[model samples]
Target chain A: MSVKNLEELNPIQIDVLREIGNIGSGNAATSLSGMLSNTIDIGVPVVKTLEYEEVVDFLGGPENVVIGLLIRLSGDIKGMMMYILQSSFANVVLNTFYGKQLDDILNVDEMDKSAISEIGNIMAGSYVNAIAGLTGLTIDISPPSFCVDMVGAILSVPAIEFAQVGDRVIFIDDNFKISNDEIKSNMILIPEMESLSLLFNKLGVEI
Target chain B: MSKVINVGIADLNVALAPDILATYALGSCVGICLFDKTKSIGGLAHIMLPLSTEAANPSENKRRYADTGIAELLALMKSKGANIQAVVAKIAGGAQMFATNSSVFNIGERNVNAVKKVLESYKIPIIAEQTGENYGRTVFFDSSTGLMQVKSASKNIIVV
Candidate 1:
């Protein structure tokens, strides 16, 4: 009746998690659209079970540099959420909000860091709010932490944290599009196993 | 005419002469490279955690921790005709990529310290190291030359 590892989840359980991803990402997309005043399109969220080795390539490539915002979730859901953006897309946001353009993601200043962190916080809040409303679970999120590094390295944080429970992480992946630019941004939600079970119980799903 | 062998996270491999052993995007994970120049042999291990003793499951992959991963790497290199006595190590990619208030996330520093302890116990001198920064690193170890090239996004490539 309980699922300890990602591989133990059946198809029905997977579908339920996918539905949660859909609702959460839908709310995130709406909030992002309102912030930029642009129409946003979100792809159907996918729940993928990946090994730690494959986590790097899940974004794009291991060596590819990216801007990552990590938010830790507590209370009902204990896990991490990552907002990953490419350099070009980050530059677009910076230019749109502060009229500042960044030549490189690694060259981000403190002000730019704060801007990106705030954006991540808003998007994560929207997502958590939607999930909490649906499941009636009390969830609290920490302030977003910003980092610009290789996507492989950035994703390693979650991979290491969750490796003890299982060799694989079942993460929800959401892709977003703004205007005509099909920027490849990913929103990754990695809820802990206990939190996952709690979420499923709240949703009236048998794991 | 040398090929680059990619070592993924929680993995380890040994290479012959003229070939390069590479592990990409090492954040908190430590990539330990052991090179025997005389025989032109190199081995690399990309480890995520500090110790295997603290692992929740004993059946987990040995290459996921510094203590066991480095030991496995050395044993594999010796099997590949490497002189264990002549082997020196070059380590990179133990970085605190993000600033967090919680010390629980300070795994990067702990991993680096664990790697040092393992290598020292094995009597393998760490000739060069690039660690404890706020960025990710991709490392390439040349077996023929016993040189490790450390590359970062914002910094120039350095051969250690």
Candidate 2:
């Protein structure tokens, strides 16, 4: 972990990060498509090194209710990963992931919860696997822990983590759309401050 | 005049009688509310970290940590003429949000413990609390009655 602030990343550096995201999210998207048996497409990720406070705005306001899947990345890099979907997407998730009847979004049973968590687990595994394969860094991810709560609350976990060391946070967001073009899920990867330097170093980008 | 003011993450605010101080989506963080029973003045702080040690050197925000945030909250209420000595606290939040064994950086527990220590050192008694669950909370502290109404994400509502 590098103990320095990244006020900005050069275009080349951003490009490198983008490629990393592209590879990782791309692999995850393929597996997700296979698991859901539906067409799932991911757009090019938007990478940003933002202030700790600014990151929560993308989650549709801190107070907006969201269903989130969280995991911890250990091994060579330590950080947090979250997959959040709007309630509007709950039916699709349940229909496609668990083959369960789509009813009221609020009627999520323990099985539905487990299914959502399993999806998160798979996505996390696929994401880290791709990053490791590309960067040659060892990555270990924990099982998915699920939560349904306010976006602000879910994001507070990472926000406070980065705030502890500094005010800068680096992350990538890949918007995934379902068959109908409605964005059903937002994939986020919060690489630790140290891990950013490690990745950049591997790419030969100076801090 | 019923007033409800929202305090953002790592922030603090104060209100007078018939007014309320509130904060939303507190997960793995602590909300400290101090009320002066005699003056009917209240202050609330949403602190994110346990100690200032974790704050970056030359910390620009003292209200973001428990050690500094609690003291600053008391000073703010006192500045408004609310006697710190007469202040009794009703605290909430400090939820884990997810189960993990890492007490080292288990920020929710740390924040809860830190807030308690700080308030104790200041000789303020904690009269009520709602904390340490795996759910986010929306808390409303009514200065008029020194009452805190807590609404959990899981749909549990209670007063403390």
Candidate 3:
């Protein structure tokens, strides 16, 4: 069995991917909980196959400003992971770390950027570690590239980067909460076509 | 009460006078606004890639590439009473949102260049532009006045 594109993913294959997201985000949430020293909870992971136009609105609209951290995945499973920090989430982290809040999200200084990057690093590291452990695949991630921009612009990177293969994009949405604040940050994992096939094969799922 | 007509990513639309053509959050993608002052008609295209030739699936969608998208937009505007000789363009977006060492990630630059080349090929002069920065832009183009308002989160709004 073979899958031609992301849109061709079967129901069972989708379920497998959802489970992968579940395990990965669950591990990530635990790591975040330890780092923030707060009780972190995650909602059930959602996997959606969307068109390029729909991706922006799905991230709370195109004009929505966000902190975007991108990590390139190489080696066994090649692709990229994008971690978006919502303003509320960034505020929570900032208040916890330095007891300071950003005057404006767009004007975030280097220290704040570094802090956000570190959070992305730890969470994405744990997420990738969980996936790698489950599949026994060796994966390496590049240092995160950080940006403060509109959600539409941030998402354009992945949408254009993967446009060569297909028109549809598959994203796994993970919702996180620290105590009472519902931080709707998003972590998107987009794997290359060959890597997708390899992952399905390793998991005994027909592509 | 004029309305704002949104041209989404990989999409294009034409509007007559008194209406605004807008595209939000343009990162690496380029928004090409072609306006005919004589007719007060305008068209906008939000193109993702530089050229259609680079597309693996060339048949997918013409509006997603600079080459095909600009040509299609010109044709659309012309059909809606825009004079080809009077049509001028203003381009925006093509921002390097993420600072990376790899040239492969510089799609913003590529998109901007491709859009310029395509416009030149159609004999359309670019009247004004606010592009090639490390920030996302939301463009609101007024067909009546041929004014493009560029807005960003980190900077003051500029109209060109």
Superposed model 2: Cα runs more than 4 Å off = A1-3, A6-8, A101-107, B1-3, B53-58
Q: What is the TM-score of chain B in candidate 2?
A: 0.94
TM-score of each model, in listed order:
0.95, 0.89, 0.96
**Model no. 2, DockQ:** 0.54
* Index of the highest-lDDT prediction: 3
lDDT string for model 1 (B53-133, tens) is: 876674458889999998899889988888899989999988998898777779999999999999989899999999997
TM-scores for chain B, listed for all candidates: 0.96, 0.94, 0.97
| Tens-digit lDDT track of model 2 for A90-172 | 66778776567755444678998887787788778877887788779998988887788877787778767767456665566
**lDDT by residue for model 1 over A1-207, one digit each (tens)?**
567888788888888767766787788788878887889998887766776556667777988888889999999899888888788778877887878978778888998898888878987887788779989999999999898888888888887777767767656676777877765566677788899898889888887
Please give the distance, in angstroms, between residue B150's alpha carbon in candidate 1 and its true position after superposition. Answer: 0.2
After superposition on all CA atoms, what RMSD does each candidate show versus the true structure?
Answer: 1.7, 2.6, 1.5
The DockQ scores of all candidates, in the order shown, are 0.77, 0.54, 0.77
lDDT of 3 by residue, A1-207 (tens): 556688888899888877777888888888889889999888987876777567667878998898999999999999988888888889999888898888778878899888889899987787788778879999999889999988998888888888776767667677888879887767777888899898888888876
- lDDT per model, in order? 0.85, 0.79, 0.87
Give the clashing residue pairs of candidate 1, or none. Answer: none
Q: Residue by residue across B1-160, what tens digits does model 3's lDDT show?
A: 7899999889999989899999999999999999999999989999999989866567578999999998899889888988999999999999999998888779999999999998898899999988887999999999999999999988899999
Docking quality level of the chain pair in candidate 1: medium
Instruction: Looking at model 3, give its docking quality level.
Output: medium
Per TM-score, what order, best first? 3, 1, 2
